[model samples]
Target: MTPITSFFRNLEAKCCAACGQMIHEQAESYATECAPCQEQASFDAYKYYHQKR
Candidate 1:
């Protein structure tokens, strides 16, 4: 497989994008970050976009 396809295929194995945690949930296998990281990222993004200049 090409490098790009290999990278995406690895996504099916559950590697957290932020913390590098090994996730075991089938639902999160395709997700970039595990639950906590995803939550924190979402919260951070919300704050970043809404915060005062």
Candidate 2:
């Protein structure tokens, strides 16, 4: 497979785009924390959930 295709195929095992840390596909669906981005996403989710309630 082409490098690009291979990348997407195993996207689940890919590292974080910002921190270069490994990320699981299952975690990605929920909350995959990028070392660099830290908890930014979790905070965002918290906000969204609270707003929706």
Candidate 3:
């Protein structure tokens, strides 16, 4: 296997707060600022759906 593949294989997994999408450790750098969500880590589901207006 290639080093890049192996590196990705060892990465941890996480879910995006904004989109509920599976995010990998290697992608964290980019995922943290998801273009679709405007990079708002503060705009999670809880904040969007549960917070008082």
Candidate 4:
């Protein structure tokens, strides 16, 4: 693909829900949050659930 085509494609790319970081299609198939954000969300959920005990 041409550089300009790649640039425009990224302009409409999906971004991480938490940090608003761009998520490339090549990196993931259909990810909502980036890897780091997903990990943090998992950790937060675990901590919250454990704290209720």
Using lDDT, give the best candidate's number. Answer: 4
Worst 10-residue stretch by lDDT in candidate 2?
27-36
TM-score against truth, every candidate: 0.60, 0.36, 0.31, 0.63
lDDT of 1 by residue, 1-53 (tens): 56975665576456787999987686434577888998999999999989955
lDDT of 3: 0.62
Error of 1 at 25 (Å): 1.3
Ranking by lDDT: 4, 1, 2, 3
Name the regions of candidate 2 deviating beyond 4 angstroms: 1-15, 18-33
Q: Rank the candidates by TM-score, best first.
A: 4, 1, 2, 3
lDDT of each: 0.76, 0.65, 0.62, 0.80
Off by over 4 Å in 4: 1-11
Q: Give the best candidate by TM-score.
A: 4
lDDT of 3 by residue, 1-53 (tens): 57987887777776666687766455537555345565454567658877767
lDDT of 1: 0.76
Comparing 2 and 4 on lDDT, the stronger one = 4
The candidate 1 region of ten consecutive residues with least summed lDDT is: 5-14
- Pairwise TM-score winner, candidates 1 and 4: 4
